[model samples]
Target: MFTNYHEAIEWIHSRLAFGVKPGLERMKWLMNRLGNPEQSIKAVHVAGTNGKGSTIAFTRSVLQEAGYSVGTFTSPFILTFNERISVNGAPIEDEEWLSLVNEIKPFVDELDQTELGAATEFEIITACAFAYFAHVHQVDFVLLETGLGGRLDSTNIAVPILTAITSIGHDHMAILGDTLEQIAAEKAGIIKEGIPMITAVHQPEALAVIQNTAKEKNAECISLHDTCSFDEQQPTETGERFTLRTSKRQYPQLETGLIGTHQRQNASLAVLLIEWLEQEGYISVTEEQIYEGIRQAVWAGRFEKVKDHPPVYLDGAHNEEGIDRLIETVQAHFFSKKVHICFSALKDKPYKKMIQKLEAVSSSIHFVSFDFPRAESAEKLYVCSHLDAKSYDDDPRTVLEFIQKKSDDPSAVILVTGSLYFISDIRNRMIG
Candidate 1:
């Protein structure tokens, strides 16, 4: 049994060596032994290449406003391990977390004796979240975010009432597959028989895959294009205000604190999910409640401005599509200002493509490496770049400090992005 919170977290993170094992057999066995805590609560499974976290955040907030306790599970924590599993916007308490770990450790030890492979880090975390939410907190709804691909992610062990695919893009290609259709199939794996699924995927190939899967499973899949027509009225510095028109409801105005036009799509997906939850009598929710939830939602480290006076912003745009949105959002808001980017990426990421996209908005690029096994070094990243504005830094904070010290103009914008892991390091430093 772990004596302290930090020790518990360190022990859990130490299991990263097991890596991501495809398939849910280990997860299923673990859950079965633990009395199936997932079955104790109504769940909504969310999967996609991007926007999954933001969508989870939006859904959680709205459910709280609708007078129901909501439990959220999302990956790549911005601050602490507790943030990965939260209820009503509060991270799991260290005491409670240690207790859960102590309870589950016996099951994990038992599994190690069997022929079944050891549970991965994410699997244990998933179990912890399920046990905490269902048995301890007793949340009304659990919104689950797939850690990796939907098909075999640890979180996929849940039989959700509803499922959502925010968007299908090229991410985890080695595991999920290289093409859009293949990735979509992996994402669509969360859909179950007779369940109602919602999606904001617009890619023709990806949409076809999801539609076909939904058809086969008898899941009533709703697309944003078919069910609710939406148009972005405008983008704001704080967030975005959009217009959404659904079959039963007309929200002339919808607002969210999350940045980027892509966020409107994620928020809209959350609205649709809430609407379905209400219509199906699963959870009673009003449009006003949904609007309020969207308005108050705050997701950290994605184009999040944590400082001013030579403005510093952080975005966790690890994949190509995510980096594209990061560039777009930066250009949309900071085009008038002189922009400098402090970028880092995991070795597996398509940093070349992400860098290519940044050429349009950035005046200079400072490549910085974070502390991660797979993190791409600044020296290597600098060598590959053809951009005239490229440089490298071993210590990421030095780049931020340099930007602040050198920039006399208040309009100068400094963006630190590329990897969520990098943003995690940056955020902890800023908060301290």
Candidate 2:
């Protein structure tokens, strides 16, 4: 019923007054009002501090290869709002999204007018994705990624067939919790009773908390180490090849399009989850489908190479653990060059630790503001980074221009990293 996409998006944004209240009550109430569309479809709920998005991508690709109509919902879009919701890896069409928004506007408006106030941006988007997948597209399976923490996240409405916690770490401490144990407990909250809880390998403390939670809920706990292992292999520009060994099956010659050595573990976790799903009779999957999916899956902004000469790499490594991985990846791949870094992070992250890591890796650093309210200023970033960088730019465009001018040096590698919002801005500028 809406005339155009912009009008619909604007109307939805206008209704976002509640601004990210961390609880399931609002989502539950709104879903009840909208006929509880989330309950209509089977779901695989994924949560963690990091790697959840890439794991979701791998899972979706595998499911689609197995011939299921798959719906994937991820957060913090790199380019467009529609990128958050996808069916079979393609972003939702703008016109269709507009119509869908219009259809849901009256109910959403009523929720806003009530004592509940209004849904946050994430809540509205989660509702829209559920409605679209369960009601409109009628997908066979939905791969749901939690936006922030898992327990109180808006997307936790559905009782998923399988719940996955990809590697937990210290991110979103202000909202979730400060300690790894506390944050792991929040991520573990997504483990529903009687559902198989699949968790990536974690620190001992985090692992214990997740396992105890699974026990308390009478859910089956499957660890990455117990379920799967991998043979060490070197990565090539094309992809990395590794042999994945599951409890009952061994997959030889598995390849992933995503970079970074950490992704091998993520890919293994996805394969193991698929194995669990098959055992539970949730979906029948073939080895061929798994191989095909592994080969084709692509996730942006995680060590993604945007340019070849002068080698520009883009990553959304906002947290300490993620930054450690990013540092490792850079050292492994571009060891010869003293990395030229551009960085930014949100106010809530461990900015000091991240800056220290970058300082260790880079010869010179350029700080750029991402234009988000949560984004720290370039001057603040420079001070925190502990680097007497050659320059700093509040404007992202100016930073990019500086990089272009310096790009003539083939030995120089420009690494654009930090917050996902910063990654979104850089990606838009490059592709636009």
Candidate 3:
């Protein structure tokens, strides 16, 4: 058993050596040994290429306002590793993490000796979240965000009461597939038999894939476009304000602290999910609670402004779809201002295309490599840009200094984006 927090965390991270083994066989085996904790909670399985975390954040906040405890299991933590297994937006205590890791370590060792081989880092983390939610700190609802494609992702072990796919786009092409339809099929794997599914996907081909999977599973799928709609959307000084029209009701002046119109879509998904929960008799909430929750909800790295006086905004626009949304948000909110972008991304991502989209909107872009193993070189990222206002620095501190100096101009809107890992690092440097 581990005696301290750091040792336990190190051991957990060490399993990264196993990398991303996609099947759930090892997860099933581990969960079975752990008394099948995943079955003990009412889980909401969320899968998508982007916006999964934001959607889960919106849903969790609404449920919390409705007076239900919500547990969230998400990947690539923004600030702390403990945030991956959080309840009510607060991360689990280190003591709880230590206890959970201690309890699960033996099963991990035993699973390693089996033909199933060692559990990957993600599998172990997923198992820990299940056990913690079921035994250590049980909650009314648990939202499981898929780490990768849905079909074989470790989080798929849960049989969720509700399923949601936020969007389908090109990401992890090597594993999930290179085409939108193929990727959509993999994401649709979360739709279980007879379970009601919700999605914000509008792409005809992608929507068809999810709809077909839901039909095959005898699940009733609701697309945001088909049932719910939002309009009069406008960016607010603090966030976004939009009017949502549902099949049964119209919610005008629905506001969220999270920025962007894309966020309005994510917030609407949360609203619809809560409505379904209420209609199905699983939970009850007032209209005021729903309104207040939407207004109060905020996610960390999606167009989050960490500093003032030049306004350093951090967005995790690592993929092609994500970059497109970020561009839209920038154009929508900061159309009249000068937009300066500081960016970095994983080498495996489609950074070339992302850079092209960013270059279109950015007045100047600084490419800096961070401390991740798969992070792209600043020089290579610089080479991809055709814009005259581009610079690269291998050392991020040097770039940070330059950004701080450039922010002296009140009209300059500083944006630090590209990868979530890079955003997390920059956020810590700027705020913490």
Cα RMSD to the true fold for all candidates? 1.3, 1.6, 0.9
Pairs in steric clash, model 2: none
- Lowest summed lDDT across 10 adjacent residues in model 1 is found at 398-407
Query: How do the predictions measure up, each by TM-score?
Result: 0.97, 0.96, 0.99
Cα lDDT tens digits for candidate 2, 225-280: 76677886767675568899888798887998888877887888889888888897
Task: Tell me the tens digit of each residue's lDDT in model 3 across 297-348.
Answer: 8889999988887787899988998999999899989999999999998999
lDDT: which is higher, 1 or 2?
1
TM-score, predicted candidate 2 vs. hidden true structure: 0.96
Q: List the residue pairs that clash in candidate 1.
A: none
Better of 1 and 3 by TM-score: 3
User: Model 3, stretches more than 4 Å misplaced?
Assistant: none
Candidate 3's C-alpha lDDT?
Answer: 0.91
Candidate 3 positional error at 106, Å: 0.9
